[model samples]
Target: MSNTTGAERLRKRAQATALAVILSVAATSSLPSTNEGSKDMQNTGTTSPNASENLTDRQQAIVPIAAFAATGDIANLNTSLDHGLDAGITVTEAKEILVQVYAYAGFPRSLNALAELMKVLDMRKQRGIQDAAGRLPGSPIPTGDALLAAGTANQTRLSGGPVKGALLEFAPAIDVYLKTHLFGDIFERDNLDWQSRELATVSMLSALSGVDSQLQAHMRISMNVGLTANQLRQLGQVLADRVDGNVARRAQEALDRQLAIAPGP
Candidate 1:
């Protein structure tokens, strides 16, 4: 081949190899999002009782529990724990969720969130106030292929159906990585648990404007995780009341839809 042709071919091969490496690393990093987005449920501007009433003090605890655990907002997260502790969520549960989301959300958020939790824990200690404590053995889920399969099953449960993830088609191996890493490694950990994790996932998604599809899917999964409809209704309403400006409208809207489906206790 001519020198120009030979050089161009070599460049293409190098580019392909580089692409493969980058993709492989990404696969190992986090859970992949689905291409089909969650649809925004119709907004109804209601919670349960007032659907309009502000979250009661006890119910309000979910705010920080949801926020810190959801967005990794360190400051807000800390505040949430203090709020939860005062409201009775227990320091141990708050810390566990923060540590657990590291699996679903990522280390950066998880670590920052945990630091905030420790700070709160310290403050509580100084005052001789302790929230409910729980045990964390470190190893909750199994390792290797079993982990991957279990995570996939968990992810599917959250989605309410099978997820033929898109990233895999774009790059085949990535599918395996998500199943192994995001689904397997993280989901396997029992500390955060699936239901609570999805609650955080939905609340965090509500904080964000877009990603409506993912939010809805997680909402569906949240139900699957055993959250009562009233609790879900309470969740959105609390978000609307507390995290106003950006999420208020969306929160109110999500609450409305959930109220419809929520069972009457």
Candidate 2:
């Protein structure tokens, strides 16, 4: 009888200890989970998806600057440059955009726009408006076969497929030049992102009269690289207000045609 009584007491004690351990574990587990949930909520509150979708202040300023640069409008370039600096765009970035303009608008316009920028900077300095000089390309450019390979990959991804057509076939050397120079050499610089480059390209094409096809194509590329249709519309408005009605009208027409062909997400 005594043995039976002692065994019953021992079992009761073990059961109580087991219950205590389970309760302790449940309590600790819930606290960390609650804390993690709170942390996630806090982090989510701090960011916005729309901010990434919309053009930044600097990008807004850049659109007009690019348009004016492509058109070789010295007076408008001066005004756009002032606005760009005020909007937090750096001197180096503005210069880079102008340099990239040569690939599309020809060297005459590019060099003239760059000279205009230098004058603007000099004038701004005389007035004591110090501007930030943005960072340059971070690494050395690739060469030879490596450059061609990288450019080919970049063109494939940006175009949503391998770039091939009759134009490239007719002049195979032009294809090599485009791949090795434009995509590989210019794009691989990495100082500017692809989206900005596309934006600048679109702006330049929009300013010119005979590049409707190129403008339409870049509108698609812009959308492919996360430029919303609405943002492109806003770009038209930028040209309208900052550039002129004629330039803005051409841009809008191009955008409308492109949208009709392939509506954006």
Candidate 3:
């Protein structure tokens, strides 16, 4: 009987030990996990308004390249060109961006920027970097009346309606040039899409002072081409990050003014 009683006591002790182990496991499970805390910290640390909507590496590289080219900062332009190529901007696209510089920054700056691109290419070639030559215009550009008609249509579509203003009325020749040459001849080239063209234009304008009116107009055109206001804000962020405070401030101000006049959906 004493042996049986001792056996029962041992069984009871085993049960009590098991219960204590189960309670310890329950208490441990009830406490917050370190991994969950780590996840929360990671999310909070990386979260930002523009984090998801930030510009791509190629687009970010274009910002400083265009800005420096517009402002005639050849040294910085050279560096940006190298960075742009490294970021996957093709040789043809780089040429196109610099070529379009003339429309806003003037012929001298455009020519200089193109020349700098040539130098950049030559150096890269020496270093055994065979940069991709992007595709040319897919279709033939029209001429004469056909060209004018196509350009006017492009301009109208880009402006979101008929672009009528005192400035165009005062200088009708400028209007023709804009429709035919700028929008028609250049824009007709399909190798570079309209979105990239507008991005280059806005970057150029943002780099220059006293062109807020044009800058603001392009900001609207930027939206008309399906670039979001958030993207433009991202552009400003790129400018601030890659270029300088003043250039970024100009872009942000122009964007703010444009959005104030027409809030994006």
Q: Per-residue alpha-carbon lDDT of model 2 for 1-265, expressed as tens digits?
A: 9989877865653343323222211000000011223223211211112345567787788788888888888788889889988998777778878888887778998999999989989999999988988766655778999989876766555555566555557767867876777767775665555556666777887888876666766776676556788888888888887778888898899789867755234
- If scored against the real structure, what TM-score would every candidate get? 0.65, 0.78, 0.78
What's model 1's TM-score?
0.65
lDDT of 2 at 227: 76
lDDT against the true structure, each candidate: 0.54, 0.67, 0.70
- Scored by lDDT, model 2 comes in at 0.67
- Report the number of the highest-lDDT candidate: 3
Clashes of 2: 0
| Cα shift from native, residue 146, model 3 (Å) | 0.3
Residue 169 C-alpha lDDT in model 3 = 76
- Residue-level error in angstroms, candidate 1, position 244: 2.0
Off by over 4 Å in 2: 1-53, 263-265
lDDT of 1 by residue, 1-265 (tens): 6989867865653343323322322111112111111111101101112243333464457554665565757666777778777875555556655665554456788788777778888888999986677534244566777877776665454444455534557886766765676656655544344444555566666766555544554554555545555666677667765665456566556556544443345
Candidate 3 structure quality by residue, lDDT tens digits, 208-231: 887766677777666665577898
Residue ranges of candidate 3 with Cα displaced over 4 Å: 1-52
